[model samples]
Target chain A: MNRRDLALGKLRGLGNSIIDDVENNMVPSIKVPSRGTSNIVYDEAKRYYVLGDRYGKRSLGNVKQIKKVAQMVSMGNFCKGLVNTEKTATIREMYYVSEGWDVDFSNQDESNLIVEDLEVTMGISREDLGLMPEEDGASVYGDLTLKDDDVEINAIKSGKSGYSISPTIDEIEFLDHGVERVIAVETMGMFHRMVQEKAYKKFNCLIVGLKGQAARATRRFIKRTHDELGLPVYICNDGDPWGFHIAMVIMSGSAKLAHVNHELATPDAKFLGVTASDIINYDLPTDNLKDIDVLRLKELSKDPRYRDEFWQNEIKKMLKIGKKAEQQSFSKYGLEYVVEKYLPEKLDAM
Target chain B: MNRRDLALGKLRGLGNSIIDDVENNMVPSIKVPSRGTSNIVYDEAKRYYVLGDRYGKRSLGNVKQIKKVAQMVSMGNFCKGLVNTEKTATIREMYYVSEGWDVDFSNQDESNLIVEDLEVTMGISREDLGLMPEEDGASVYGDLTLKDDDVEINAIKSGKSGYSISPTIDEIEFLDHGVERVIAVETMGMFHRMVQEKAYKKFNCLIVGLKGQAARATRRFIKRTHDELGLPVYICNDGDPWGFHIAMVIMSGSAKLAHVNHELATPDAKFLGVTASDIINYDLPTDNLKDIDVLRLKELSKDPRYRDEFWQNEIKKMLKIGKKAEQQSFSKYGLEYVVEKYLPEKLDAM
Candidate 1:
């Protein structure tokens, strides 16, 4: 049988075309594990198969077309054989997986491939990679002693070049001076706004969300900052619930990730700037007050784990005022207000 | 032993709260198949007993969170006294498969949980009464749909209703009316904007895409739309390839649902409007075009499946223009201009 028929018609029809790819030499841009079978030959024990055969007996469709599987693992490997044989290694900056077969209102059930994680694997070492690090992903930092001695640090250390991710491990290095801190902003849109106002060079900021989910990834990075570099971390989020939840997830740890990796929050770092205080502190707009945010705050406070000191106190402040504050509320403070109110004031302490 | 320590902790730390929830309630929010003993039970197969009665006398997390060997069946008819009370009834949705150790990612991975289709019931049936659809934890369209069609649908659809879901099945009927055309916009924010412009109310536009990521569920609704209402559908999407592909999925069908149900989109339906043509026709901004999106369009033009007539002509147009068009590009034309440009000027042909 031809490879296409063997891979599709005979092999239970994954309809994968990587079989022709393996034969023709289609190299993937990302890295695939040097070991393990391609999606071809299923493994009952591991519950998935190496998509293609390492022996060249089987074929894989082009790795790019295969969405559901961890194609990057196969792509970067086979791509070396296809496009470049001189270098066998390729680094992975992101990994996407599906929640699977997204069903819609129109009877269109396409595969729902969500970007699972966008980790900085280029600089991660196997030694640095823990089997299940107290966290799922690992973060690295340069240990440094900065100029500021009196200001207390409350976040993961900052001060790394984020011109873009360095492609190789060897290219990854420590910053020459420690005057600035590298605060990974999850979204580039937010970063651009911050930079337009000169928010980060003043404190050493690293723009993160340019490629990944940006928000959750930054939290993990900051936690890594805490562990690897011992930088104090603080979260400046919108006073609204979604923003609050994102910040809280960093603080409380995701239940899903709790099973997978570590949480990144200071035992003491707290949500700053976007507070009910911002509503009164800056006389912000109340049209933005959402009923759900109020409801969510009440729900969060009632949770047994958060009923204690920090959350309850913050929640009670809003309950007393019956107001909601959002990170956007600080925008009225203008770029200068954000820096002075939260960032610079905090940096001055640093 | 604490419930968690039992069964050698095989299903350890996996949604443990779900088990404690079962301990207190008989018909828990999630109804799991009984991990009963193997006595050649439900299907009258080779009746065997467990190594011990450990499988039969199981609880999600009671005296001990033990799942008996009996609980590991591909089919559930063998067990007696399942809480949902199915004697000959097939397993429709598995609540907490004692064996669901990993993430449920694909149709095939999920198929493994079922011994056979005969062992499980399929589709919504009159028999599945008294049970809330959401209780099954299966995908459900559960929210309100504002009747205004001009509103940028995606924006309101983007609103968080403390849920990942939007618009229940009952809600769709309210909007269907005598409308002759159904346009399922995958992005709702754009739909809401159109509503503000009085596009739907003015021109009888039936815009979908109030829910993101529920593409599969949305597809089911489309099947209902076509089968129940003979509306000629037209998919309006971003000019990029994924948008093009999503339109293809709605019309041509996807492999994942090929076996389960067929015929959501009609063969005669049109794939119209908001494609790469907008980049040149309207001069839309490229500032926010994701790099990956540009690459995907390039790849789409090259793929053999898409190289044929309609796709080829459209893709070539984009390449010639060298620009990507987002749905928002239509904003320049205003709702009136879009209807003037894309919609059939005469609907009497219908």
Candidate 2:
């Protein structure tokens, strides 16, 4: 069955169970995997966060749980209607859609939590349930042809700006490509420069500009591209703690989104510079590390994600140097310095 | 000559005057149009802000002005290099690009001001000088086909997410389209629904999602499309004051960007919906007007941009009702209610 059909079947089963309980004169309850930090475990073998065996039961027998159960039921019904009609709604729209139901949400955050609850209960993604995010995804450029909802687009030839990774990237199929690796850059300035210089052509790689910490769809797109195409994923971000965190989230999994790490994280992905060594070795323009940056570095150094000798040493060196540099700092040499020199040198070493 | 040639000419003229002054032992001075509020005047005929004939002279002879003049010269040389090399730099990159130069900016803001000063002095845009913003522009979808750097993309057929209005939209050519009007929606949620339902096909219009306040490229793209294609531009936003301000900025130009309003503003564009009348007439789910919202409404009512009877009436009605609604609030009726009922009624009235 298609993802939507599977999600529909799960939704029907959930509804039938509750109805069966009511018919048998028993209290209706739903068991959800607890999503607390304590329940989130770092899986060493798989190299991403996975849920531990912890369950949170919500029953209609309790007065306080009645409203939440009602809200979940309303949301489930809304999702069913969306899947049945072959339409989709954003999280914001879902919140607004609840206004018409008997049990409405007080605010968007409350509604968002219930959606997460529903996801954990059904073991399905919100995308399969016909829900989507409001923001657009990454800016992808290269020789890859992406097929979205049956529409084929040549990423590089499409436009000067390249292809925008769609929010509904679950349906996007990587039809064909002529690339060796996928280099995901964090900043837009660096990404645009790479596109202008056609850096991907020289390296035989696809350039994915994350814009910042990537959106869910962007992470998923990168993960899918890596798994399906067998291309190595390299993350290029600023030489700082925050940048390291963003890279780690993509490589491993973030605590907040641990549930879906299997679908999002690219454990095999490599972190490319701006490393502390590169900062010192290249004599690039630098900024003084803030207190928060130092604190984050100390924290990351201890985290299991950065347990590797390279990451550990880099974190320690950064802390010792007390400096950080951005990807755009290479513009000091010239606009094409990063793509022509830094990237070529880094890639050759890799 | 093309824009790049024109910009180069202006840059050379500025350089020549300085060299000529030094040769003749005269004080090198650059005359810049004062961009203060006092010099920014609303053009009634043009329906946008225009710079008045107030000049600010900076001479190298003054001790305080030496650094400023040096910075301006450095910026001019940089722009010339960009134009001659046919390379573009983001304002952020421009800041870093100055590190090797004699006069480097302390921060991005100082560099941005110099670029603006260069624009006002040269009477040419940064785009003409091969400079771009760091952020990407709007998301557009519909029947329109855009030709960028000699590459054509059919917006609807391109991808599921549509065409991302390129950051360097100055180079994009709107070749041809079969659409009647362009509907610019302020929110992404509404725009996504419109795209999902093929609402543009039924209305014979192009849908441009602004994401919030539009970037300069988005406004330029819309203005160019309106001027070149003879398509009426309609703005659809929320029922609150902030939404009205966003629409007004697109239609009449904003104060901060008065210098480039001639190229950005779409004066003839109509505000289509989420007005006070829309909130009451359609009975949309709304939130109580915050203090800030009320204050903005009062300010807008006094502003000359909303002097029209329709806008003035809506402002007063919104204050009286003390309510505000988002475009997504229409989802309370059903997912299709907007494309089916509300939009058609609003379009008929227009």
User: Whole-model Cα lDDT per candidate?
Assistant: 0.38, 0.89
- Candidate 2 regions off by >4 Å? A23-25, B23-25
List candidate 1 segments past 4 Å from native.
Answer: A1-350, B1-176, B210-214, B261-266, B287-291, B298-308, B333-350
Chain A TM-scores, one per candidate? 0.48, 0.97
Q: Which ten residues in a row have the lowest lDDT in candidate 2 chain A?
A: A157-166
Across residues B1-350, which tens digit of lDDT does each residue of candidate 1 receive?
52112211322222343456557675222223233333212111211111222212234345332332123322222222221332111122222222233322133234333332211222221112111121100111112232222221211222111112221222223342545566655454344334434445555655664233234435555656566666666666777777787776565454333322242334444667565555655565433446786687777777544545777888777766666665644434432344455444323323
- DockQ-based class of model 2: medium
Q: What is the TM-score of chain B in candidate 1?
A: 0.53
Candidate 1, CAPRI quality class derived from DockQ: incorrect
Evaluate residue A213 in candidate 2 and report its C-alpha lDDT on the 0 to 100 scale. 86
